[model samples]
Target: MQNLLSNLKITINEKLYVKDPETSELGRKILKNSIILIDEIGFESFTFKKLGEKIQSNESSIYRYFENKHKLLIYLSSWYWSWIEYNLVFATHNISDSLNKLCISIKIITQNIIDDKNTPHIDESILNRIIISDFSKTLLTKDVDTENKEGFFLVYKRVINRLIDMITEVNPKYPYAKSLASSIVQGALHQHYLKDHFKTITNLSDKDCLSDFYIHMIKKILS
Candidate 1:
């Protein structure tokens, strides 16, 4: 899988950036350090100027890649989902059994993320923390409707749609595949958040147990 992903380039929406951050060394530095800096400080307090300081570049140079912090957050979210979609596709492509495929897909989406040594520019483990903690800011905004129209959330939706298809295949008669699929993805994030912050309300105290809980619930619901 590492070899397969060695050459992978996760595409982000062009509209989310003023320039392609993957195309230059300085651009890549912006991306690499931005993820680290954002992980160090929550997104609400993150700014291009701070990111620029971390990268030792002029603040205006950061704007050359992103229009603002909001767009950068959306770019990061899009990139994260695209990476997940890649893993989901590669992991499940060879499995013929629908339920088994769905189970693996669930594990892929809901399981804890670790850094992939194959992608050096981005620390997926840290990025996963950002997704779990701050991904909502990318969507729960006043511009979400307009951004949705612009397809800013396309990769994220595609991830859910893949699960939707898998769910339908597992149980063709299941009528709520869309809702269930969306819930599984969103719920996984929420559960992880609760496990980290509001532990009293969630039984998913263990990282591995989180996946098991969802797999169990999904089986019961689809069966």
Candidate 2:
């Protein structure tokens, strides 16, 4: 499975970066280590200079790939959503039951990420950590409208649209499939954050219960 995953290539929006990071080794290192640094120190404190020092490359080299840290953040987010959409399809493609597929989808979204050996450069566990903590920052910026116009959010939209299709499959007449799909994806991540930092506010007291709660919530709503 890891080997198969290694072969997976996600096409991120060209507008997200100045150069294609996947095409060069230094670019890949920038991505691999940036995820680690951001996960360790948080995005607000992360900088291209810090990333350059970590990767042993000049700060200018980092800029050759991404214009700024925010672009890199969006790039990582896009890559992550693309991977999630891939796994979602892989996990649900053979299932005939819409509800079963939805459950599997929820499981994929809510479950803890395991580091895959096939993609040695990408530590998915760290990437997921970044997603939970920093994903909204990608859109919650003044340039978001400009970025959106450039198709920077396509990968994210693809993830939501895929889930929306599944929700529609389960309940064609459901009035808010898109809303529910967005809620499940973003809410699951938010719950994970709440469980970690504000345990008293969330019913998800532990990681193991996250999948069950979301699965149950989605099922109850769809039923």
Quantify all predictions' global Cα lDDT against the true fold. Answer: 0.91, 0.88
Query: Please, what are the lDDT tens digits per residue for candidate 2 over residues 78-185?
Result: 988888888888878789999999889889988889887767788999999999989999989898898898999888888888889999999898999999999989
Summarize candidate 1's per-residue lDDT along 1-223 as a digit string, tens digits: 7678887988888999999999999988988898999899888889988988888889999999999999988898898999999899899889999999999999999888999888888899999999999999988989899999999999999999999999999899999999999999999999989999998888887445877888898899989
RMSD of each: 0.9, 1.3
Deviation of model 1 at 186, angstroms: 0.5
Candidate 1 CA-lDDT value = 0.91
Candidate 2 Cα outliers beyond 4 Å, as residue runs: 1-3
Q: Quote the positional error of residue 167 for candidate 1 in Å.
A: 0.4
**Who wins the TM-score comparison?**
1
How many clashes show up per model? 0, 0
